[model samples]
Each structure stands twice: as structure tokens, then as C-alpha cells.
Target: MSDTPRATRPGKTPKHGTGGRGAAPERDHLRADCANCFALCCAALPFAASADFPVTKPAGTACGNLREDFRCGIHTRLRADGWRGCTVFDCFGAGQQVSQVTFGGVDWRAAPESRQRMFDVFPVMRTLHELLWYLTEALAQPAARSVHPAVRRTLARTEELTRADAATLEAADPGALRAATGELLLQVSELVRAAQVPGRRKNHRGADLMGAKLAGTDLRGANLRGAYLIAADLQRADLRFADLIGADLRDADLRGADLTGALFLTQAQVNAAKGDKTTRIPAGLTRPAHW
Candidate 1:
């Protein structure tokens, strides 16, 4: 929801639309190829003392737990060690792209002068990749066929920007691009949401629903796009056919919630939220191992 793509573990790749025509190719580049990356997320980004991070780290500074090999020293113990943020952070594959492609495989450690450039370009690359993720999703929406041509062109433009040089990437304004693509996605969402019948309409786009009690609510086919559901009591809520694109679900209780057919529910959101084994999700997305 921060516009920064969320991170997922190696084995937990995002499962896109089922049998979507002209579905984008496998997003291997959008994934965190840590082996090929120089730990851009751990080094270029900053973190604060919170439930997700153990200590405060300044931007462009390497995290204390970062290893010489560009892996976290306590990677396996991140959650237990009060670094829950690391577990939920996904770069959408910008780390490896900037490391291997933009910088020609030169690492920040070896070239100190390039470190700042690498850090600056990393976020730009990430934003572009995030746009790619959305555009690909738009193309997969058969219901939004009217906008597929524009979506395809936009996707191609974003892909070209991702392949730009470091200078171009650093100078690129991705917010404007995201704004333009967001308009198209909005149209797509309208087309998709129009088909579903809501038991009770819940138009809480970007609304603050944190800590709100909504247990056993009939939210079938509700549009909860960009809703802030942090720490909300959603126990046993009927969220079937709900559109949850960009919803902040951190710490939202999902025990026994039925999310079957919920649209645009990312793995990152699921990983950040609270749930139990009884919670039902759509097919293709496996429940987090930690949950």
C-alpha cells in the first residue's frame, strides 16, 4: 500500500489470475533473486524500531544484520527476533534487476562511489516494477477487455523504463506514471466489480477502519480497495468476492474469515495479517508457513 512492492520469501511466488488470456509471462524478474542481488533492500532502505524491525537503521546504510554475502545473518530468525517487517517486505524483483542489469553486476561494496546511485535507482526501479505488476494484472482481466490495448501499451512503456540506464531511472518520475496507470486500473476494477452482487455494499476505499469491529459482517462482493484494516476485528467475517486491492491488512484478525474468491489479495497482505488454519482463501494462494 506504500507503493513500494511487498517482499516474499523465495519459494512463495505470487499466484496471478487463473487461466487469464494473454496473462503476463512468469514474473521471475519481479521476484527477489537474492542470490543475484547485492542486498539492495537491506542496504539502500531504512528501517525504524518497531514490531517489524529490531533497531533503527538510516537510509543508504547497511543493516547490522546484513552479512558479507548480502544475506541476513538472522534470516531464519527474523520473526522471532522482532523483525517482522523483513518477513513482509517484497521488492517485486527490483533488487536483482538493479544489481545485475542497471549496474552491470558491480556491487555496492566493491564500488563505494556507486553506492548512492545504486540506492537512489533502487526505489525508482521498484516503483516501475510495481507498476508492471499492476499493468500485468490489468491485462489479465478479461472483463476489462476494453482497456487491454491501453494497458498493454502502458505495460510496454513501464517495461522499457525498467530497462533504462541508472541516470534515466534516477531521474524518472514514477508517481506520475503510477497515477496514469491507476486510472486504467480504476476502470478495470469498475468493470470487474460491476458483475458481482453485494449482499451489502461496503465502499471503504482508503477509509480508516483500524480496530473497527466487523465480525460476522456480510461483505460479499464488497469493494474494500485501499481500506485500512489494521488491527481490525474481522473474525469470521464473510468476505467472499471482496475486492481488496492495496488494502492494508496488517494485524487484522482473519481467524475463520471466508476470503474465497477475494480479488487482488496479495501474499504480502496475507503475510502481514493475522489468520488461523480455519480461514478459507481462494485457490492458488497458499497460506503462509508461519501462520
Candidate 2:
């Protein structure tokens, strides 16, 4: 009924859409490729003139490592060259989603005037894509089956946010977005923990549970904003730093756990508690400053 033509003189499990077997999904059209993108992430994001790189760059300026073809010239040795940030950043299909889905593959180079629009929307698109990644991950939880409907609804909402106008997207505050994602993630956490470790009650907010055994936990800065927590055990956690705007205390257990500079956790979140002193605060927040 889809106007799809019949193949093989009958029905032998009709071929995949016009593209071929698993073509559209396999294509992952939502993913970006430098071969097609303008390297917007590199061009739109700014980095300090730190030891990570030889120079500092402003937003919209191309990194020194970027070539005319929009590929990183030092792709193979970014870490050695202090561009390690580039190596770890994943746009989560934002680049391709914006390029193909939003703009229909209209390259900035091909349409110079489109550059302004592209730059303006790049940041918002990245945020939406990042949230999309987390939402997709949240939906994968078997224990969170109880809230699958909510997850689906939120996922749809976030997806719509991605397609919003620049004004609307920009108007979306980080705090609000964090709250939305946090609500879903918290549900996911409780579901998984309840299903796996029944009768286990872990006090998260304002409680110093450092060096605690928190294996297979998912605590990506679930608020805890301004809570007191020093040296809590957090291992095998899937932390994406989405809700780390203003967490508290420090010296928490983070061995084998992936903190990776979770969002908004200040030096206070580290210095006040009991971490290895090596507890990773977000790159934007550091010790001594909070001290």
C-alpha cells in the first residue's frame, strides 16, 4: 500500500525500501562526516589558549588544525598535539542531522550566505543532539520499563526541541534542559537499582558516600546541585555531565567511575568531600578557585 513496487515476481519478504536492505538505518543519515560537513563543531566551539593547544580560538573561527577540506589535519595525533578535546567530543549526529535533515546538505562553502544560519544554529543543534544521545540511552534500560512511556514522550519532546527555531532553541536555558533530562535519568537510575539491588537505599543528595560501592550506576550529575557529598563510591557509572550545574562537596570515590568533568560540579564539590583529590570536576570548574 506504500506504492512500493513488488520484486522477485512475488513476495519473498519484500526488499527493503528503495535504498536496499537496511539502507536508511545503516546509512545513519543523522551522523556527520567531515567529507560533507563544514566542520562546524571545530569552527563553532571555542577553546582556551591552554596547554591543550598552542593557541586559543574564538567561536566560529576554524581551529588551526582544520584544513580547507574541513578535516582535522592532525586527526591521527590530536592528543600528542594538545587537541585531545576534539578527540573526545562526539556531536551525536548533530553535525549530520543539521547538515542533511535540517538544511538538506546545503554546504556552507557552496552557499556562503548560509554560513550565518549554520553557525547560529550549530550550538543549539549540538545541545539537542547531546540530549538525544542520553535519551536514547535511557530508553535502553530494561528495569526502567515502568517509565518507557514517559521516556518515549520526553524523547519525542527533545527531538522536537532539536527542530525548533533558533530563537526557541536559544531561549531554552541549560537549567531547564538539565531538569528535564535529570528527571528521566533519575527514574532510570531508581528503576535499574531497584530491579537489581532490591532493598538497597543509596542516599545521594547532601550525603558524603565517597568510596561507596556504586557499580553499574548511572549518575550523570543528577542535580545534587548544592548538596553536600564527599567521597562517595561511583563506579561503572554512565555519567554524561548533563545536570552538573551546581553540585557540592568533594573527595568522593571515583575509581573506575567515569566522571570526566561532569557538568556544573564546582571545586566545592571536590574540595569539601573525600575523593582521591583526583576526582574529576568539569573542565569549567576547578579547585583553588572554589577554595
Task: Please provide TM-scores, in order, for all candidate models, with all chains considered together.
Answer: 0.88, 0.60
Model 2 C-alpha lDDT per residue in residues 74-123, reported as the tens digit of each score: 77666576664554444545665566545666666677877777777777
User: Candidate 1 lDDT, tens digit per residue, 96-206?
Assistant: 788878888778888999999999999889888877766766666677788888888887788888878999998888789878877887887777666665244778888
- What is the clash count of model 1? 6
Best by lDDT: 1
Best by TM-score: 1
Error of 1 at 110 (Å): 1.3
User: Candidate 2: which stretches are off by over 4 Å?
Assistant: 1-32, 164-175, 201-291
